[model samples]
Target: MVEQNFTKVKEFILLGFTADLQLQRVLFLIFLIIYVFCLLGNITMIFLICADSRLHTPMYFFIGNLSFLYLWYSSLFAPKILMICITDDKSISFAGCLAQFFFAAGLDLSECYLLAAMAYDCYVAITNALLYSQAMPLRLCASLVAASYFGGFLNSTIMISKTFTLSFCDNNVIDDFFCDLPLLVKLACDVKENYQAVVCFIMASNVFTPTILILASYLFIIAAILNICSIQGHLKVFSTCGSHLTAVTLYYGSILFIYSRSSSSYALEWDKVVSVFYTVVTSVLNPLLYSLRNKDVKDALKKMLDRAKVS
Candidate 1:
């Protein structure tokens, strides 16, 4: 079989948030702050989870994984974005772009499964409190974590492989910050109908499949919560799941709006703004959502602070 030969794109110019000097500086400052906060928040979540024995349950285990994913997701793109803003060097090599896409896609897909797994954990804890530990044993929790990473790697591998197969004859300018699929596909001179179909199929499978699973898990979870007779029990169950529900809604809402729609109709500026929400804002929010909302994390942080002060 003749392997499709691609004209190696020496570099890709990433048209970041804006080209206006003042606006670019302002946006850079904003994203810099966001990047710092995202790093601190995720690190805090990880430290709290590790330091506190009280949060050794499956819920915290999944939260720890979520924090790790957000860290990777942000690290994959944010640094490049910051550098682009400061140095105004938008040139990224073909190999570099593909590498960025691989990591970003892997982390994004892993997060989707991680969110679903967290929902499932909630379902087990709320629906089967008596057997929560038995249901979500340590080994099963480890397996879930492994499955998220495996699914992510598999999805990223397929997309990256398919993407590199196409020839980039023209249109090297990517109108976004990073090497995203839609923009890369648009750049390919050999863009085929089958390639489009494959992309659509991948997006559907990666985006919708886990969404359905998470929704279904929550359905059963709500049912279980309603079945609880005591008002306190109902409140407790709702409280337990509220933070996760908020995070899911924010993360998936932006993704669905961007990916589930026709690319032709996609408003680039609006889509970029929404992308910021998911990529930057969501990363910052996850740690706050899990830590601030959960008493266990707060207590853990307090203990760590105390230990620091004592030392």
Candidate 2:
């Protein structure tokens, strides 16, 4: 019975941006460049954090996992997008597309919780500076990261199982670049309240839960900052958290607009454009936000570069 479900569609055709040869070639080059840059930025951040003893902290630890997630997250869709651009072949087998989405979703979802965890780390580091080390102990940090991955795993599992169980009785051509959930849901022959319930639950788990936690943590951090007498203290607090705040705004804002609503309300064109930021551009921005913005990371990277020059 399960085999029948799996065999219902041997493959799916992805109706990507366009079919024009000239445009396709242009897009290929564009995506290739972005992919290369994103990989370089993320990999460099990971290299810097790992190589430098100074970065061996809970904050850098989470950032390392985030860089790894960024690498895989972009890899899931960027390669497919570039391949379609180069070959103009958008056909992907059921297992291949599902696998791509599953892993990608896991990483994306993990990033959300991970960001929230990072925010909590910031709050502790700033608001509770005296006990920051003890409060967010090494063991606790590792556990939080593990929990983020587990949460993402559950999210991806529910989404994939629920979505694929739907009857794709007709056309299998997904009208977007990648196997997006809303776009895929639109292909279903039937959608019930149960489906919406599942989606809402998934949204709450991945989006609202994390957003609320981040906001709550920041609220306390803000209170802590407001209590400071000197302006320098305020600036310090904001500098410590500004990059994370920017990243949270970018990621959660777009996602809330796109996924928090019902699937029936999805605007395919708008969704496609918005998804590019979180799916592709975020991978590029994360390293910059989490690492490049930090003085420590910049100094470490410069030192490494000069050492390489000498060696």
Candidate 3:
């Protein structure tokens, strides 16, 4: 009977935002708009960075990589979300659900490392301005970016193997919009306390490790900024790192709130709302945050427009 039950869950039902047709329609429209804006914003950022040679620096390189990540990251869930909202078909195959979780976890983990790399880049630029070019050479930048991606996906593979190997007997309904790890863990049959502890530890490590690196990099950055004597220098330094700090805060804040809890203690409704913020809302906000607040990006856009007009 136990083995039979474990094999019965061929698919899982996702209880998305609402059951009401009217509300789902409204959400569909809203998510569609958000998805479109996310794509356009990231695409524009990527294009501007690529077209303008003047904007090609370590900072913009990281920024471009971020936009690139957003493009694929947001794409992973948004379309499926749109389909769910519109068709009211929340059924996901067992394999499909695992695939979604694997990709989502990998990309989100990658972003954490990428943000840390960006923070380090900022620290290097401020602390060693004279040697900025030499310090952040193309080869080194490439290696850091490569490591971020590799580390993220590698960790995801471990997580997926551990999580999915458990027997998800009988219960096939996920309480959140996505195949969130905690909710899936709740579905496992006869899960031991030690197993749960191990899962939570792994998840926390994924979040906290990058967070510590980011905070450490900023500590050095702050120390470097304090040496600047002028008030204008302080503001300039703050402005330079402000966008990145905001992004980090948003990403880490939501992740900590969601992942730092015992799986049994999750407020499912609240998790859904916060998930939307980091997963959907952040994608749209990042391009604007990094581009609009940036003088070089603004200049690049202006120059591109001017060139178009002349041609």
**Candidate 3 structure quality by residue, lDDT tens digits, 3-78:** 3334468899988888999999999999999999999999999999888898789888999999999889888889
Error of 2 at 137 (Å): 1.7
Off by over 4 Å in 3: 1-5, 265-267, 309-311
Itemize residue pairs with steric clashes in candidate 2.
Answer: none
How much is the lDDT of residue 262 in candidate 2?
69
Model 3 alpha-carbon miss at residue 253, Å: 0.9
Model 1 stretches with alpha carbons more than 4 Å out: 1-3
Cα lDDT computed for each candidate against the true fold: 0.86, 0.84, 0.87
Stronger candidate by lDDT (1 vs 3): 3
| Highest-scoring model, TM-score | 1
User: Candidate 1 residues 62-164, lDDT tens each?
Assistant: 8898898898888887888888787768889989998998988888888888888998899899988888889999999999999989998898899888888
TM-score per model over all chains: 0.95, 0.93, 0.94
Model 3 has a clash total of 0
Q: What TM value does model 1 have?
A: 0.95
Question: Least lDDT summed over 10 consecutive residues: which range in candidate 3?
Answer: 1-10
Of models 2 and 3, which has the larger TM-score? Answer: 3
